[model samples]
Target chain A: MSLVTDKIISKPKIETRDLGLEMTENNRSLIEISNFDFFYGEKQALFDVSMDIKEREVTAFIGPSGCGKSTLLRCINRMNDLIEVARIGSGKITVNGVDIYDDRVDTIELRKRVGMVFQKSNPFPKSIYENVVYGLRIQGITRKSKLDEAVERCLKGAALWEEVKDRLDTSGLSLSGGQQQRLCIARALAVEPDILLMDEPCSALDPVATAKVEELIHTLKDRYTIVIVTHNMQQAARVSDRTAFFYLGKLIEMNATDQIFMSPDKEQTEAYISGRFG
Target chain B: MKRYFHEELEEIRSHLMLMGEKAVESVKLAMQALLESDIELANQVMESDDVIDDIEKQIDDEVVRYVSLRAPVARDLRLLFVAIKASHDLERVGDEASNIAGRTKKILAQGLPIDAVARVPRMCELAINMLEDSLRSFIQEEESLAYSIVGRDREVDTLNRENFKELVELMKSDSANVSACTEMVFISKSFERIADHAKNIAEEVFYLLTAQSLKEVTRGK
Candidate 1:
């Protein structure tokens, strides 16, 4: 043991480095939000929110109740506009480098490019085939052959074709909770949206059904830049490439899914994920 | 409910600590058995291996249950995972201790002069100290100490290598000393592996603390 050498050796110690908590760099940002502030009338809901959601990647927003993860998600598609007092107090949000709030922008056309799924699988009381083609129909796609093709393609894309193909005429509500969610996904896919915003899409689902939607989310990311807001950290970890943590309207941390779930840079993010506190 | 999960996490830590204590005891007992040529103590060390194995099984079962039922995340998730991982390494350490004890019985049977194997006990003490410290780091959350043990593994490896080199020279120098010297080399090898196990525990503690693999963090360093 007394044999000594000139080779320099440094002892390994777990040093606490100043882990830079910021938006994780991606190859490209399909949607970039910079200093975006949101308010519901007098109350500011978001504070200088900034993030880059990459192209054709699943990015999940996770936080505790009232963390405003959902609020930031709603900004992606202007879903917050439904609230009468909702308004952007500062900064800009751009989808594909175009300001979504531009006067020249068409909100309906923007929605067509950015389809959304909600917490509840709100499939209209229509036939399964009707539900899948609801968006196309709204765009005035009346051709039966075109609608028929869209139904098969989108349902298959959503992993629901094998389950619901036979009962094309069956009411959308007739499907199970998981199947209903998949149907809602199919309906969103039918419009060929470049971005998909899912807000707690599996909160009302059973495990098996939740798994199906999660699997669908994995498959859907190849074609759409998906942003999902999930209270279920496991689901977000299971489905997304990147994850963003928001707390009390502040963007806490965003990194690769494994990084966020395993060792988040921020103590707040770790506490929230570890269930220490929210 | 959250308190319950943390309690389970604490329970797993306690189990690992118990397992670590037993495993470290085996190392100390095996060293004693080798130095004193005590056949009874060697056999006792070998027989008690089942305790470590049983604890390993319990940790595994509890981990599966914790993962499936609790759905742990972040530090909670890392703790559960590291519990299973560290227990496995401790079990291996137990096996190494048993192997050392088995070698002690062989050396004692040959009526070998334990003086030739004096260096092996020193190595055993170093390895045992590292093992005990690794577990202490985990139980006490002295995270830096655990990582320091990881870096110290290189010293163990060097000692084992140098001892082996010296033993092989002794075997070649005198035909009569070949058997005992060869056994001494194997014993040194076992100590090396035990030190490796200690290093593994240190790595697990790093992951348990930071949710980052020690190897990954140290790779750049």
Candidate 2:
């Protein structure tokens, strides 16, 4: 017998764009995964993971330490390509109906379309304008007017234009921690990525800074698909439209953020959300 | 990690059980006052009603505190929701006990007449048993036992109905018996309302267990 069976199923046919189709107003899915598995050398990091990332939505990954939430976030942009021993086995990851892992897909192009921000404020040691336009410079776009326009547009998009516009030529490190993080976001936006992946982006910031970043995230989802991995349950509840809980390399539960936080179906998910255990 | 909300919830449960016990004792004492024509027991039931009222306020304050602070959900939410309801029922039980005490006072002031206390005492016993069973079902989370108490409501209903008819017949047979019969009717009505409140508590227990409204269940039945 085949391991997978192709069963014929029928669902109510609804038009995607019809206003009268009884569809939810937010009806776009930007990414979908099916039975995805990830491994680092001999050890499996993710098992049978499947979920969807809706466009213009904030999806949060939350779980205990070593639960592979960060690993799963990396899979969206193939960040694991930088890890020598990491491998994907027996699954598919698609972004806007394009298979990301296909041989024909250019990894650089993929990264351009899917940007990422790290936990720390990793602003390069350069002028603020140069940091925001670094990706364009790497692509050999040397027009000064174009770089200036891109800098202004990206900084404004990141809600950092007012604070940094006066100091565009100053060193990126001169900004405060929260400003630096927003600068990193501006840098990511400069690349014009369709999706943004943040891995514990506010874990190192103070509460005030964290609140600013969280509010920025909530605003950013109007333009970019956001996938964030956070260990803070309250942060996940506050920011994400949907949340997935991972446990020991397995995807235990995934649902709307309210359901996940307020009344999760799985007992383990409930315990974790209720702070019974990590 | 502190789980302060869970601790507060447990405290509410303990206080509700304590209040339930006090309400039951008040009902029993008021019945004793009626049967023995003892004004002292009647006064005790009235005094204890104040304690029940105090605990009801305490439970209400704790529930509001937990809701505002923790925003408890799922089973915790259901527990708190039912705690608020159960406290209201217990307070009303205390009120019913006070009402019974008032009836006892009136009957004692006017004198018990002659040989007419037996059926009222029996009806009081049945109503108190129903109240005790209902509270037990609530504290134990026993839905089946709660359903059985729901079944027992009909017995109390029948007793109250029959007792009402018997009192009316007594007043008709002797016009001088009107005042005492009227007092007996008031006492029987209080017992009937107590049974109704006990039934309501049992239904709330069922809701806490099943998440389905008891009103819906009876409508279906």
Candidate 3:
């Protein structure tokens, strides 16, 4: 980044720590991870970590790489189950009061309720309209009118409709990196998932694209319980209502994003965020 | 691990300390000029104020650069906040000292009796003490010392109020010297304002340390 030469001499406004994003009685818990421990074969990956994610809130998981932030995120949707060596060592994860690991729970249904966008934009080899309706098509909804409505609604929900409405017939891969990410987001919204999990969805894009994706996250946060895992601390500070700092597989501190960014409770969290940590 | 940006942060800290020292010197010399009726020392205080202003600009530039390039957070972020605010307060203290020197020059030119300006020396002492202690608290990160500076401001305020009343009486009784006594009133107020800036700087230090407003912290007590 080039140095900013414009001198902006303004008094710094000291903000009140609380940003009024506190989880009140109305903000019910949507996902609960209790004493959750996990292992990849014999190597333990997650310590006894626990936190309650509230509905309609954006909770960010931030830490150095290999700190189990992504591991914990994957555990929320049981995405780690795909790895043959990965297994839950102890404790349970409940989504809306239902133990997702229980034998009776369908992984497919669990995934439909909790959608995920990856670190990379993975728009399938399909048209823009086809990509948005892909989730519905898998559920055996093949009617053109129904799929068309889902395409419009989901694309609009993801803040991509205006730019891509005319390009519905174009390949999803043909869009720019940012457009592709938003297209993937539109696909996630097609299922009308109650929770949206984003894993560094803007890491690959330029600042303009990153800003668009962050704006989309801000808009989507009020309607869906959003959990984002990102290596960019500033992005976490900007987009998250609540931020959780993790280190060495242990949850260090979790608090309102304003408090976490301004004055984190833990010394380790402070060191890490301030770039003083080893 | 120390980041590459740590040096820039330390640079801003050093500049702030230097600015504090210059601001203190300005106040001390302004008072000395008044006591000795030295027009040369008074002019020097007025001229040296430009240095304090330039340092404030320099600190502001570095702070903005660090915030934009490095993206500081937590205590580092709080330090930036304090750096901006404390430097501004120091700059205002510089202005107050200059105003006092300007008024001192007016008193000396009129050949005013120095007897009417007795309380000002004490006021200047309290103000300088507060400013120095505030800077010390910042350097030492001493919370209690910063907290103590806030309370001591009342003594300086009371002295300024006394000076104002006595100067008013002198103006009424000694009609021939009313012009010089009027200058004394503003000089006393400038000292009081210097103390106020010092108190503000101390509150900023408290905020940098605890991330809590000193006013909010003491309001409960």
Candidate 4:
């Protein structure tokens, strides 16, 4: 696999077959969350939620405000650990059948395998080349030839190389809002994460820019497992292979995107996706 | 609380219902014209077909617009798809009714006896009933009612086959009545086609309500 590079320090060793999960070209489960609960200090935020996201497919999380879609997304890579009060209440989340929350697992190595793009694009106030290669630089890969190659490969992977190829040395912040978001995506790709988590990646962008980012996401899924949390039902319908609907910090329903949008098994999912309720 | 574009869906729905009403009305008028041998009523049935055709176009346009702009999902999305497909079936129903009326006009011009179209009225009544029930099933979200209508189409088909045999026999028995018998056979076939269209709408409504194929479900039986 082109995405499984040397940078991914420790690939989770547990196989899908060993986990007794069904395996297919499109449905090989890459991430499994079983009976997982989460909390923000004393307040519970996620109930016993569970689902398996397939490898190399886009899985979208959709629900109303404060519904814990983003919380669950952050848990996949332990992003919630940065919050002072956040903690796992129970259960486990595993990538390749290995518990991500395991003490033996390295957090840095875990994040290197699961990159995230924020709703707002945050460029590091450096040149575009530097932004793409920042993760590698921080890891002490300072050879000029290595950095140059990483920058080009990451930028191309992000679908931004053609737009900003002429201005490689220009400040990352100098790009348009959409270009900046793609730049952030390029930055995420620099580490060649096995999974990409995006939280409303297009909410801050214009429709045209949103379309470009969506297009990038469509192509990126070929090389990465993508999980997106979005309030936009149409965006979820357009981009995801599978869709999970959460409500009040509980997993309400999760199914194929076509089934979720066309005729969801649960009325709660139908109600939310159709804007019939909060 | 409903969304604003739901009114648009309602409008599309109303347009579809109006088209259904017009289709049923067309078939009824064509039947009445054939029974009474009324040339004026037959002409009226033929002329009013444009109304059903126009409503179908309007329903199609609204469905397309709603799908593109409203971005409906789940039940609402299914309703849009049903609207498009059911409207097409209703349009064909309108066409079949018009064809029946045209044949009725030809028979009336020849001064043929109304009894020549022996099994047609029965077929028309069965088909129209099925059509009404299909439309009702759609409006009320009645899945069983829609499934019930699919089997009823076979009854209309049987009557049409009998009519074809009877009309063919009448033609051979009396060469003088051949033209009238020929028109009756086509009219009977038109009614059969209308019933087929009605069955299609029923299947569509079944899908709209349950998202299951009536054909596939019934195929196993």
Please provide TM-scores, in order, for all candidate models, with all chains considered together. Answer: 0.58, 0.54, 0.58, 0.60
lDDT of 1 by residue, B1-221 (tens): 13323577788888989999999999899999988779999999999999999999999877775674356789888888789888999999899889989988887777664456757867888898899989999989888988899867677788888888887777777777788777888889989898888898898888888778789888978
For candidate 2, what is the DockQ?
0.03
Model 2 residue B158 CA deviation (Å) reads 38
lDDT of 3 by residue, A181-206 (tens): 99999999998788899998989999
True contacts kept of 4: 0.05
Candidate 3 ranges beyond 4 A from true positions: A1-26, B1-184, B187-221
Clashing pairs in 4: none
Q: After superposition on all CA atoms, how large is the RMSD of candidate 4?
A: 14.6
Q: Candidate 2 on A1-278: residue-level lDDT in tens? A: 11111110122222222212123236477788899999999899999999888888999999999999999899888878777788998798988777777755556667777899999999999999999999999989999999999999999988899988888999999998988999999999998887899999999998788878887897898778899999887778777888999999899999887677666899999888877974
DockQ each candidate and list the results: 0.05, 0.03, 0.06, 0.06
The count of residue-pair clashes in candidate 2 stands at 0
Clash total of candidate 1: 0
lDDT of 2 by residue, B66-96 (tens): 6643557787888889889988998998999
lDDT of 4 by residue, A1-278 (tens): 12222223364443334333233255688899999999998999999999999999999999999999999999998888677788898999988777878755566767878899999999999999989989998889999999899888988988899999999999999999999999999999998688899999999999889888888898898888899999898888777889999999999999888778877899888887777885
Runs in model 1 deviating more than 4 A are A1-27, B1-221
Best candidate, lDDT: 3
- Per-prediction share of native contacts kept: 0.05, 0.00, 0.05, 0.05
